[model samples]
Target: MSRVCELTGKGPITGNNVSHANNRTRRRFLPNLNDVTLMSETLGRTVKLRISAAALRTVDHRGGLDGFMAKARESELSARALKIKKEIEKSLTAA
Candidate 1:
C-alpha cells in the first residue's frame, strides 16, 4: 500500500538528517498513518480508511466522518473516500 493518508492527502516529505559533523543525508519524513474504521452517521455504516494522526484528530474535531467529509475537498480524497463522500452527500440530501 502507498504511504499516504486517505483522508487528508498527507504523504511523505523529503528532508535532511544532519550529523554533528555537519554531514547531511537525505531522508524521508512520512506522515504518522494508521488504519482506522470510522462510522458514518449519514450512511449508518462503518468505513475503514488509512489516515494520518492529524487527520484523525481533525475528524474528531469536525464531529465525525460525515461532518469531515462534508467539508473535505474532492481533490484531496482517494477513489474509495470520494465514493463514500458521494454516498454520504446523496443520503444527506435525500433525507
Candidate 2:
C-alpha cells in the first residue's frame, strides 16, 4: 500500500537532514498514516482507510465519515474514498 492518506491525500514530502557539521542529506517526511475504520451514519456501514492522524481528528471534528465526505474535495480523495462518498450521497438523497 502507498504511504498516502486516503482522506487528505497527504503524501511523503522531501526535505533535507542537516548535520551539525554543515552537512546535509536528503530525507523524506512522511505523514502519520494509520489504518482506521470509520463509520458512516448515512450509509450505516464502516469504511476502512489509511489516513493521517490529523485527518482522523478532522473526521471526528466534522462529526464522522458522512460529514467529512460531504465537505471533502473530490480531487483530494482516492478512488475508494470517492466511491464511498458517492454511495453516501446516493443513500442520503434516496432517503
Candidate 3:
C-alpha cells in the first residue's frame, strides 16, 4: 500500500535537501505511519488502519477511535476512513 495515513490523509511531501556546500537534492518527507487495529464497540469489530503517530495520539486524546472519528472533518480523512466513519455514524444512530 501507499505510504499514506489512512485516517489523516497524510502523504509523503517533496522537498530539497540542502548541503553545507550550497548543494540541493530532492528528498521526500514521509509521514510517521503505523499499522494498527482498533476495536469498534458499536460495530463489534476491529478495524485495521494505517495512521500517523500524531493521529493515533489524537485518537487517544479524544477518548478513542469513535470519538476521534466523530469530531474529525470529512475532508481530512482518506476514502477508506470516510467509509468507516460513515459506518460508525450509522451504528451510533442505530444504537
Candidate 4:
C-alpha cells in the first residue's frame, strides 16, 4: 500500500513555495510516514503498513499503539474505515 495513515487517514498535501523575491513555485508537503508491522489477531499474521505520524497519533490518542494494533488485528475493516483509507490514498496521490 502507499504511505498513509490507516487510522486517521492522514496523507500528503499540495501547496506552493514562496520565495523572498515573491515567486511562487509548486511543492509537495509529504506526511511523516513510518513502516510498522501490525499483528492481525484474526488472521494470525503480521501485516506491514506505511502510515503517517498523525495517524499513529490518532491511534495513540484513541487508546495507544497496542490498543490500535489489537483493534486492527482483531477487527475487520468497517465501511467507515474503508472510506477513510480511500480518501487518504486519493489525497496522497493527488499531492
lDDT of 3 by residue, 21-89 (tens): 989999999999999998887778999999999999999999888999999999989898899999999
Give candidates' CA RMSD values in order: 0.5, 0.5, 1.1, 10.8
Minimum summed lDDT over a 10-residue window in model 1 is located at 40-49
lDDT of each: 0.96, 0.94, 0.92, 0.57
4-91 in candidate 1: lDDT tens per residue?
Answer: 9998899999999999999999999999999999999889899999999999999999999999999999999999999999999999
Off by over 4 Å in 4: 39-46, 65-95
lDDT of 2 at 11: 98
**On a 0 to 1 TM-score scale, where does candidate 1 land against the true structure?**
0.98
Tens digits of per-residue lDDT, candidate 2, 3-92, equal 999989999999999999979999999999999999888988889899999999999999999999999999999999999999999999
Name the TM-score of candidate 3.
Answer: 0.92
Which ranges in model 1 have alpha carbons more than 4 Å from their true place?
none
Instruction: Name the weakest run of 10 consecutive residues (lDDT summed) in model 2.
Output: 39-48
What are the per-residue Cα lDDT tens digits for candidate 4 across 1-95?
55456555566788999999989999988778887765533334455566677666666565744446444522334444554444444554676
Which is superior by TM-score, 1 or 3?
1
Most accurate candidate by lDDT? 1
